[model samples]
Target: MARVETLKRQFFKCLGLLAGCTSFALWASQPQVVEKADKTELEWGNVLFEYYQKDYFEALIEYEYAKTINNDTAKSDYGQMLQGGMLLSYGQAKQSQEIFDRVLARSADPLVRNRAWYYLANLYYHKSEPEKAHQSLAKISGPVPSDLFPEFYHLTSLINSDVENLAQAENILSQVPEDSKHYPYVLFNVAIGQLRSNELKKSLINLTKVNQYAARSEEHASLSDRATHGLAQLALKSGNLPTAWANLQKIRTNGLYSNRGLLTYAWTAIKIKQFNEAIPALEILQSRDIAIPEVQEAKVLLAHLYEQQGAPRKALKSNLISIDEFAKGINRVAEARDIIAKQNVPEEFVRNLDVIIDDSDWFGAQPSIDYQKLTPFLIDLMSSRILNETLKELSDLYAIKKNLENWEFQSNEHLLIMNNADKKSISKEERKAIQRSKAIQQQLSDKKQELKLLMLSLKPEEQKRFQSTIDSIDKEIAILQSRTDGMSRLSQPYKQPASVKKEMKDKHNQVKQKLKQTSRLIAKLEPVVRSLVNEELDKHEERMRYYWAQSRLAKARLYDTTLMELDNVTSNKESGEGVK
Candidate 1:
């Protein structure tokens, strides 16, 4: 259930999956052990079992198998639809689309068709195609499963809100029971739609409802964090410093929005003239990984805050550190970019994706970087949203590639299982002797031929001079050829029967086809992944360069300030000395 929810969070931006997220959890929460489960039920049940356990690799493989059996069956439409939802969570958009579309076309059952339409509509909505979403939604007939009611209404409300049809959206939203698990997600999405329409008053009210709900419950900590942050931003815009500060305080220190919250928290304190509070917050932010843009800004803010507190030396010290740090970061991004540009290394991009698998608060304000491949310097470069989504795309591509590899392996393994195997081996001595002597024999033959050609143009004296060399070469070639001939004779023990050879050839071709399929996918995918990674590296370099320039300018201004102050003190001392 948690794994499904986590995947939903990752993909909800594009899939509009929040509506159906609770349904999976409900599925898991049920009593799943059946004493005499039907064979088909157990089969599809195992797929969901693996998925609920968060073993997505095996689950997807199982689902692929189920699809082969379940295709074109009305009874299997539900399982297919469920797997389509799972695929959507996994960011398998194209595959999910096919599954849903297939369910809609073939399944006469309203439950199955309606479920497909709702998923398709949600996918369209989250992708910002309201017209397409509405078209999909319009295909739905009267009755749906009780569990799908909230999702349908919530999804409809979201579309209406997106179109600025606030009254209709509100009516649809009211249809969803307030106690439903999906209500908060509904409120959050509608509020965002309101925000887009500049309906701040309505948006604020909805965000406040979400914020209040998040505060009271621990279920949706991330949504709570977002709501709290949104409320703070709204408060700040309205000059409600105290309210903004209060909301900022509500965000978890270790939460996804912590970095952004802290930054805003500091400025909110400053606005309310709480210098002591603001200073400590800024200091904490300055100590964080500068890969976050907020952290980068914090360094400058801290320096300026120190200057504001009438501490020029402290400000200058901070600016100097900023200059050095930005310079190092700029250089690191450049070096990493050059390496990526020169070499095609998929492992480098894959390293950035470890955080996605292990710690997937990818949509959070501070994305985690568990493996900083290339260099620690490129962490900031890979932290952008574009790169993050690209990483998801790579994740899907890798999953498909892995599935192909597993299929290829299984096909080869099956040939062995069927007892139709071909064993091709050579003795150690024979193999080594053949491999070693073959190259030397070729070189010796060429050398001997060259010598004969030279002898043809040379006098008898020249021929005599080269004869010993040619003799040495001839001896080497004779020895190598004898070793090669002996190894060949030993290796060519017996020929296979024609029937066995043909069977082995056919199986081998099957294996080869699988290999080709996997190789082709990798050959196509790696360049695209590398290109996106390279672009992020380039952006990181550009950002670091900008920060370095800013730091340098700040450093110069601080130095000038120090020099002017020192000169003033010196002049005052001279006047005092003259008067004395």
Candidate 2:
């Protein structure tokens, strides 16, 4: 009981550390807003308010609007940095990189520069470019803002991890105050770093301490099961069967690790000739609620055990049952895969798919597609890590794509309103505003090229790292070129005031540009999502085919055994010594 208590605490501590790394990554630490006021000041306040409320989309909109109207160029650099981070969170990594570069190139503020450098380093870290990311981090002038410290340290640790600098990673992790909520997790991280470095003895010692220092719950018990399971496997490898058995017993019976545990437990029992325990365990596992490869393998082993115990008939019956089950499973999976291949994954399904992040199985549940169509097929794939991850990525991409579409729709509506506005009473100020819109449109064209050139110049490593960004920009540019080549009105009848007509033209151009950008973004992400879905389906089909082959082989072996048994029975009768 005490051991279980300790296990839960240690595991939960590690889990919380992971949650911190994710949920506290970038904008989660932004300072909350206390007041809202009106133009730049007002928009900025709303940005902060929306951010604090976790309404990141609204916050980004307010920030972009604030940028358009704000007069303070110095402060704009800082605000753009924040906007860049929000874009990164929205999976707009390439756009975020552009913002970071612009801030670094134009801003002289140390604090702003530091924040910008930090984000740039973070972007590099995500790209798996350690040296480049490290170079970016080195450009920071002083301590990062206090609000950014946690995420900053996390990124540093990631860099250190990539470089195999375990000493620095451990040292940084060790700085967590003992009283802080992150303290246990920091200790957990140090142990993990040691484990990753293959300092197994040290890691086990630290893990032991972690378990001793904290209390626990069943909620995060799977992590404990995983650690214990590893220890069992290590013991078995070293010929310490007793130690392996004991360690395997510690795993929870209904946790994420339970399926593999039962399979391991039964195998270990069979190896030790503990038939009483092994048989019942395998029997219990033969139930169809779980269909992991481990469970299927255990069933095969169970039949072999029966054969070894002289129950040839029982073994044959068991193998036949499994062969039948596998046959149905293969056919059902094929039909399901065919159905999936015939239709695109529904956008709404991908958009609504819940993200599951279990360390044991990742997306560990059936996808959000119509289960009725693929019921039994999907059942066998519940614990697929690849499917989980692919589906989750698709969900996020679809969601971002939908957001871009909404923006595109809004721009179209805004353009229509501007195109049809009453022009009889236009003021001089409004005309200047129209001129400013035209100038900004020209600037947008210039900046689009600038952002692309920057994308092309990113650290060259198979071009895979920044390829998505470059492709997106190329697609957007191509879209613009196509539109430019297709149609234009060289002249227009001026029904409204001359200024009003000019304003209308400028507004029309701006709206068209915004619409193009949004449409291009949606276009860029949709194909990536569909390709991932297709890849996931292909991998699943491969697994099903492999399962079918294994079952066929097992069945063939069972048939051979039956023939041998019949020959033995005939030989015994001829000898007149076998009459049981």
Tens digit per residue, CA lDDT, model 2, 53-92: 8677888877767666753521577677878888876667
User: Model 1 off-target regions past 4 Å?
Assistant: 1-76, 79-99, 122-130, 141-143, 146-172, 177-179, 215-219, 271-274, 335-370, 373-390, 410-528, 534-540, 578-580
lDDT of 1: 0.70
Error of 2 at 537 (Å): 5.1
Worst 10 residues of 1 by lDDT: 13-22
Show where candidate 2 strays beyond 4 Å.
Answer: 1-42, 71-78, 102-114, 134-144, 178-192, 209-219, 279-285, 288-291, 339-346, 355-400, 407-420, 423-580
- Alpha-carbon local distance difference test for all models: 0.70, 0.62
TM-score of 1: 0.64
Determine which window of 10 residues in candidate 2 has minimal summed lDDT: 484-493
